[model samples]
Target: MVLVSAVRDYISRMLQDISGMKVLILDSHTVSIVSVAYSQSELLQKEVFLVELVDSISKSRESMSHLKAVYFLAPTSENIQYLRRHLVAPRFGEYHLFFSNILKDTQIHILADSDEHEVVQQLQEFYADFVASDPYHFTLNMPSNHIYMLPAVVDHSNLQRFSDRVVDGIAAVFLALKRRPVIRYQRTSDIAKRIAQETAVSTVVYSK
Candidate 1:
């Protein structure tokens, strides 16, 4: 099976176990992730009637405790903040969190810390971190394209962000295949080398 298919299977398993009407809540990045692989029609088939961004969903005070919320989002700080706010005043009957990649212990602690209402039911890593634009190829879809041309000293944090996303994409590819790969990056390309190293390091850590 392909990377996209693996992620699809993980999602299918996540939703199939939960019976009844569901609302698929996604973060800004995951909208494309779920939309491309799982269409609106397909989601409807699975009884998912609503698709809303996490931030926007939190803004509306309208309570819809009738529907179960399945959250597929990156384990980003902003998403965590949004989850914290929602736990205080939950609109859905239950919440199932599926992070695209490995979540930090601090992140899990934050979610647990915020979940005083005990609305969150599950937390898992589904490994659909990259946007699958086509069957053979995928893109990290990093927002800042200009980072590669600049030196690391110019913007250390942005460079880290760019590298982290690329590494995440590469890790998702291998995790989907369920295989350990020996990946190489262009030596001349600083960004590629850094990303490759980070990917290898993260893969080792995760696999262990």
Candidate 2:
């Protein structure tokens, strides 16, 4: 229940203060992040009338000035690009940007610069990046699950990306709880050890 409660609290905080009809914009990854902790009926109760993928949200050229956009997405380059396009020709009256994990300074700068229309009202990091399957079990839902089993030498770039994401997920879990944990991993697995060490560094960095 820890993971579920933490994610639910984050979602509640995001929606509770915002009034009027809202359109929730999620990425492919955040769909799982939200679905695990919330339901469509709960969103409707919060006055969220629409749920849409960031990539698909702009497919319609129609303006929706009555509905505000509440975007909860991972801070990825592709998602950033999609946001840039949306900002250029905004369909919603207001945007509340909430990233699932910590975002780079440059990424924030890029977003701020792109918002020429001043449609964006708020920018925040809520740290509900991983999928909570159960109270004691959570998953990053990594696409390259097989890559983690391979040696770091093979496809070094992808290996590093995988490790970084692992660290991010772990850091986000701790951040959501407002705690900094000393991460431990199995001694037999090099990947686990690497993830733990990186997570420690990331946790410290993000805590500040």
* Top candidate when judged by lDDT against the true structure: 2
lDDT of 1 by residue, 53-74 (tens): 9988887999899999999999
Score candidate 2 by lDDT. 0.90
**Model 1 residue 42 lDDT score:** 82
Per-candidate local distance difference test: 0.82, 0.90
* Top-TM-score structure, candidate number: 2
> Can you write out model 2's per-residue Cα lDDT over 1-208, one digit (the tens) per residue?
9989999999999999999999999999999999989999999999999999988886888999999999999999999989988998998999999999888888898999999999999999978999999886899997658767755557778778888888888888998878889776888888888898988888888789
Q: Report the poorest 10 consecutive residues by lDDT, candidate 2.
A: 144-153
Q: Give the TM-score of candidate 1.
A: 0.93
Pairs with steric clashes in candidate 2: 1-135
